[model samples]
Target: MEAAIRASQAQLFEAQAQLTKSQADWERAQNLMQANSLTQPDFDSAKLALATAQGKVKEAEQQVRVNNGKLTESKANVLAARARVDQSQGQVDASVAQENRSQAGVDSARSRTVGARSNVEQANVALGDIFLKAPMDGVILTRSVEVGAQVGPGTVGFAMADTHHVLVTFGVPDILVRDLKLGQRLDIKCEALPGRTFEGTVRTVAPEADADSRVYKVEVRVDNSKDVLKVGMIASLDLVDKEDSPRSIIAVPLGALMPNKDQEDAYQVYVIKDNKAKLRDVTVGRASGDMMEITSGLEEGEQIVVEGGNRVNDGQTVKVKS
Candidate 1:
């Protein structure tokens, strides 16, 4: 900037010097004209020279103004550069701070990870002192762990289902999945409970498919308040047709009775009325293979026409094949 100012000042001085010489020459010419020694043309020429010199001074001054403007713009550019440097410095500081925090988090997580592993080891050591015990006053149905066995956290010591309140499990087919619901009535029978009848309801259904049996696991909660039922005792799980049952009742297919399909919102079934095939809607209660409950929209002995329903349609005549 200083260099630029010096150059502009030098140009102005040169212009001033030219103006001074023109004035001195013009004065001499004026004197000559006044004495009639210089011609009128010569006097006019001197005057015009003075005017041109003045115009040069004005032009130099205008150039100075332009140079000043350039200097101002240069200063502004410097300030902008400084501001950018400051902004960049702030960003670097913030990034460094964030990196430091990340490093701290990593260190903390490492410590926690070590502590978690230690706690796991300690838990295993403590299990050495903890012995498995029977939970209730009942016969043991299974023994998964023996004396001096090395067991882990998830190890099963034994399985002891309550014998005092025994209930049977059965399958409900997909065809009858719709006719059952929770708390629906069930007719249960066991050779052990001969000459006596036991009543139950659809209790629990599995939420997954059983790959081995291809059937659902359905649970029937029985009222063994009498303590007559025993665990592992096989029994018949009888589901009453929902159609024959009253309102608020449900039935499902026996196969769909598997525990897994219980989570299904509903099941499907077919209805045959007045020699016409109609798709009937019903709610699911519990799953039992090959059969289910008719929670609603059905009645007992209604000629359900279970077989060969795939070929029939609504309002279409279908002869009972068997």
Candidate 2:
């Protein structure tokens, strides 16, 4: 395309040169005719020649114009073609950037895959240790692992009862279950311990009732730091208070309250006052038997006698003393 344009430009330049020469010659002929030095016929012939030369000059000029116009169009086409080339270059650059981004993602995925493979190997090694061995000097609660049986990680090889700390399981009726979160402290006691006391907390609760039964599975996390408790043991449970209830209404028997209410939303013990216990509605927040968080109702230093509140009436005047 460029070669063709150059050729046309050359032709335009040649036409321009020829037109200039013809115009100069015609001017000279006109001057001769006017001077009368030439004969009449010769003058007429000169005039005719001049007119013909002028015509030729005009024709040459027109030819130049035509060639120039074609050249201009060719130049425009070349400019447009170059613009398309530049745009294609930009697209190539963008493709390179995308390729680099994808390469980085692939590298990350490969690293994660390697790490996961290592974890699987570690898990397999742990599973290989099914051979029974005493974890520590302790009594076993119950052993369910047999000589050769495929078991999952959650399988209890043998329960140590750890006697050092205990965990109790129970259900929190739906009526009392609500808004109970993990880590809330609880007071616990077992029939085997009788008067002895324990402490625990809301550990976990079932998301749905068991298929066989409609009770919410609840777990109370207890600490037997003194090694006085064991696993799989039955214990009475009571939630001291719901997270939002007031502290004053959470009082309960140190022996009756267990940190393991399987996570009851809350519980309350109304004190007999003014001769009536009033069963005054209360919101328990947190409790530990000695005292509880009263989210609402009850007051600081109010008489909440725990001895015989079950028989009291609302607003009843009774002996108010701690």
Candidate 3:
């Protein structure tokens, strides 16, 4: 547009120059015609030349005005385009700011969720610590703390006793321990409960002897479903072998029994079958003298190793003595 305007201005200047020269020529021709020195035709020719130059000047000036208007319009278009660009940039900036704010809000919510979950877990632990659960079914004999009382670690909140099954521990000499076995029944007499005899079963017999008393500890489990037996009461039990009414159990020599390596308070014995020593797990009952009762896992007619039984292994070839 500038180029067009410059070309139009140059054309205007050339036309103006021609108009000046034509005016000068026309004036000289008119004076000569008046003095009868120039002819009428020549005078008319100069006047026409002047008129043509004036018209061309007017046309060039008009073109310059048109070119200037077009240049102004082009500049207005450029300004409009810049405005649009600015507006678009502003919108993009606003969108980016909004996205950042949304992300911040999301992160804050996530942090709060984590904190809430931690609080919930801590509350659950505190609730568990607030209540006391008895290890087994029993009655609470004593409660040390009142309601709303503060209790800390190792606080004796309650004293409980299991009335379903009562445990009686007693000491016996080593000679008597040889006859005691698991599941043996004994008559338990409590001094406080007169004329009431609670039948108890032997649960455990000590494997080692006590150094001070040279006695073994025996545990008895007595059923007290009626809640007749009280805790801390003096009780006495009698160990009597029911020999007259024998249970017809399978008995084996004490040497044939070995402690099972995999189980606690369990015994295993080797049985001779087709000249092979096969190890068998057995539950034992009362022991009388040098013989131990095999309550299970052995047949009546089966042969077993009595002497040197520790040297044999399972599934080994063995010779039976005649």
Indicate the residue-level lDDT of 263 in model 3.
Answer: 72
Per-residue lDDT over 1-322 for candidate 1, one digit per residue giving the tens place of the 0 to 100 score: 4454565577689889989999999999988988999878678878999999888788777767766766676556556555555555555455556765666555655555555555545544443333334567666677686434577778787777666666667655443445667888877876556666688878887665565434466778788877778775545654445555445534543322222234433444556677676666554444333345555557766666554444445578866666
Name the candidate, 1 or 3, with the larger TM-score value: 3
Error of 2 at 164 (Å): 2.6
What TM-scores do the predictions have?
Answer: 0.31, 0.29, 0.35
Q: What is the lDDT, from 0 to 100, of the residue 257 in candidate 3?
A: 82
What's the candidate order when arranged by decreasing lDDT?
Answer: 3, 1, 2
| Of 1 and 2, the candidate ranking higher by lDDT | 1
Once superposed on the true structure, which residue ranges of model 1 sit more than 4 Å away at CA? 1-132, 148-155, 205-216, 240-322
lDDT measured at residue 304 in model 2 versus the true structure, 0 to 100: 62
Of the two candidates 1 and 2, the one with more favorable TM-score, higher being better, is 1
Give one digit per residue, the lDDT tens place, for model 3 in 1-322. Answer: 5555776799899999999999999999988998999867678889999999999899889878876776676566556555555555555455556765666555655555555555555544543443345688887789697534677889898888878899987666554577888998988777567678889999999889765445577989999998888886656665544343545679887667887998755679988999999888887654544566676788889898887778788999999999
Candidate 2 segments whose C-alpha is farther than 4 A from its true place: 1-133, 143-161, 240-322
Winning candidate number (TM-score): 3
Clashes of 3: 0
**Which lDDT tens digits does candidate 2 get at residues 238-267?**
553244454224344432222223335333
